[model samples]
Target: MKILLLTLGLGLVCGLQGLDNSAKGSPKLDGKWFTVALASNVTSKIEEGGSLRIFVYNIRVYDGFLTADFFKRENGKCIPFSVTAITKEDGSNLVHYDGLNDFSLESFDDEYSIFMLYNIKDGEVTIWGELFGRTPDLPDEIKKKFEEICERFGIGKDQIRDLYNDDRCEKLR
Candidate 1:
């Protein structure tokens, strides 16, 4: 009985430790990020004045959740917003926000990351490809890569929107 109890305690400790590590997340992902571009299978969702047309500025992870700081233009004014996504234990970085969001880090380096988001909201599914850069502007090649990714996901070139020069909420920072 004592041996069984000891084994259970050890297992519990190991489980908790794994959870803590997952909560801490990768340091590389915890930092300032700029919204360079956005594309979606549902073009209207990424179009100007769309609900998904948000400019992200920061990302941080804590307690197994990833929170993002961003701004959305409303009534010709920039409105600050924040959303938290619960990181899954499956190591997929999947999170639930306004909907079920499954994020895949398609590509990443020191300066940029392209995330493809599969979201299901209100029974409608949308796939979005987002390009985030360490700087406000990325090279044309990077943009072209993002376009190719979007195309692969059935998002047309016309659906992509460039937001590098639309930092209207910089003052709020």
Candidate 2:
């Protein structure tokens, strides 16, 4: 009887350990994503400091949001973002908002671009869209560079989209 009870206790402990691990490493639905543009490019042409930029899409689940900001990097320092507003929305929702540090990738020639990433929590999913833009359109070469960044981040649009549900749509206009 004692041995049986010990075995049951150990089994329960092991089962719970497995459950805990899976819970913490919960994969985000937006785990893999892509960046379509940069923010500075969109803001430069606008005289208004309130220039809007940056849009992320969850080509997988078809939902996400972007809050704009101006990002600046100093010598030997991490890029700093200045969030300008508090835009809020429901999950999988897409809305245009301003208030973030500008990510200026001058190499791209587009008036707009995107950073796509998703947040997965408790098996629930939400997409995040980081939008960037410029006065000029993004050159093909620069566009490729942006794609490279997405690939490096494990957010390649092709690979993830292939695995995600096919019903998703591109929300950015």
What TM-score goes with each of the models? Answer: 0.75, 0.26
lDDT of 2 at 73: 22
Considering every candidate listed, which one attains the maximal lDDT? 1
lDDT string for model 2 (23-46, tens) is 445433222233334322223312
lDDT of 2 at 157: 41
Question: Against the hidden true structure, what lDDT does model 1 obtain?
Answer: 0.71
lDDT of 1 by residue, 23-129 (tens): 33432666788889999888787777877787888977566566888888889899887887644444444556557666666666667878787676776767887
Looking at model 2, which ten-residue stretch has the lowest summed lDDT?
Answer: 12-21
lDDT of 1 at 16: 17
User: Model-by-model lDDT, in order?
Assistant: 0.71, 0.30
Clashes of 2: 34
